[model samples]
Target: MEHVRPLPTYLAQRYHGWKATTFAENRAWYKRLADEGQRPRAMVISCCDSRVNVTSIFGADQGEFFIHRNIANLVPPYEPDGNQHGTSAAVEFAVTSLKVAHLIILGHSSCGGVAGCYDMCSGHAPDLEEKSSFVGRWMDLLRPGFERLPAEADETTRRRALEHEAVNVSLENLMTFPFVRSAVENGSLSLHGLWTDIGEGQLYSLGISGEGFAAV
Candidate 1:
C-alpha cells in the first residue's frame, strides 16, 4: 500500500484510451478552446467532490461549460485577496471574458463537507483549528448556516437544507462580482439553482421563483 502501481504509465494509457477517433474529435477541442477563446454560454459553480463531475452530469463537450468547483460548492462573499479571489476570479473570467449567460450553482446529497459542518455544529466534531488546517477554514464557510439552522432537524434533512442554503449563499455571492452583478441587473445573465441526489439518480427543483424543490 506504500508505493502503488505505475501511475504515470496508467495515466498515459488512459488518456490514449479516450473514445476519440479522428484527431479533430479530440485535439481540435483544445485548439477551439484556445482559439475560439472559450466563449462558453454557461457558468457552473459546483462541488469539488469527485463523485460529481460537472461536465459529465451536464453532458457537456469541450468549451460548453465554464466550471469552477470548490469544497462544499461554496462561494465566499467577495473579498479582495489582492490577487487570490479563487472563486471570485473564476466568476469574473466567466462573466467578463467568456461572457457566459447562465450561472448555475450545483449542490448534491451526501457532501462530506456539509456532514463535517453538521457534526461540528453538534459539538461531537473535534476542533482541528488548534493547528492551522484547510478543512477547518473550508468548514468555516458553512459556519453561518450551521449556527443558524434549526437544531431539531434530522441529519439527512439538515444536510439537504444545508445544500439548499449553500446554493443560495453562492448565488448571493455571485452578485458581489461587478461583472456578474451588471449582467444580472441588465438581464443578460440568469441564475439557476440545482441539487443532485446521487443515490436516487434524481434532481430536485428550486429556483429564483417559488417552485422550491420538486423532483426533476
Candidate 2:
C-alpha cells in the first residue's frame, strides 16, 4: 500500500470521460454483469503487448471473453509441482470454473518477448541467459520453438516463425494440464492459435494441420 500511487492525470481524465459516456450509456448492462457475474464463452491468452488490443480486434463487450495476458503469451508446460503458476491458474479457472468452450492463444508481430527468446537462444542476449533472469526462464518455454526454426532462415523469417510457434507451444502446453486435457477429450473445450500483423492489422489462424498459419 505504501508503494501505491494515485492515478495519473491523463488516466484520471480518461476514466471520467469513459464514466460519463460509455459507462453512463451502458449502466444497465454493467449492473447486470455485476449482479449475474460473467459467463464468457471464450478465453483468450494474449501477450502483454500494448499494441495488441484483444477486445477491440474481436469487437467484444465487457465480460464476453475471459482474457489473460503475459509476456509472449507463452504457457509453460503443466508442472503441478506446487509452485506458483499464474497462467495455469487462469486457464484452470476459465476451463473448469467458467466452463469456457474455446481457449485461444493469441500471438502477434513484433513481440519483444519472442525476440528476446530468439536472441537468448541464439547467444545474442547474455543478460537474458543469466539464471536469475525471470524473463530468461520464462522465454525458455519457447526454446523448442526456436530450435524448430531452420538455421538458414533470415531474421524476418525467424522472428515470424517464432511468433507463430509461441502460439503453438502454448496450445500444446495447455493440453498438458489434466483439467484442460479432460475438457478437450470430453468435447467441452477447444483450443485455437492465432497471430496478428500489427502493422497491417491482418489476422492469421493456425491451420488444423498445425504446420502453418492462414489469413483469417
Candidate 2 lDDT (Cα, whole model)? 0.95
Clashing pairs in 2: none
Residue range 1-216, candidate 1, lDDT tens digits = 877866698787767666455454678677766886767889988999999988877788877888999888888887786856678888888887778889888889888877777777677677744346577677777777776666798777777788777776777777787777889999999888888998887887575464567776
Which run of 10 residues does model 2 get worst, by summed lDDT?
205-214
Off by over 4 Å in 1: 1-7, 19-30, 81-83, 209-211
C-alpha RMSD values across all candidates: 3.3, 0.9
Candidate 2 lDDT over 185-211, as tens digits, reads 999998999999999999999988786
Stretches of candidate 2 above 4 Å error? none
Worst 10-residue lDDT window for candidate 1 reads 16-25
Cα lDDT for residue 66, candidate 1: 88
Error of 1 at 82 (Å): 2.5
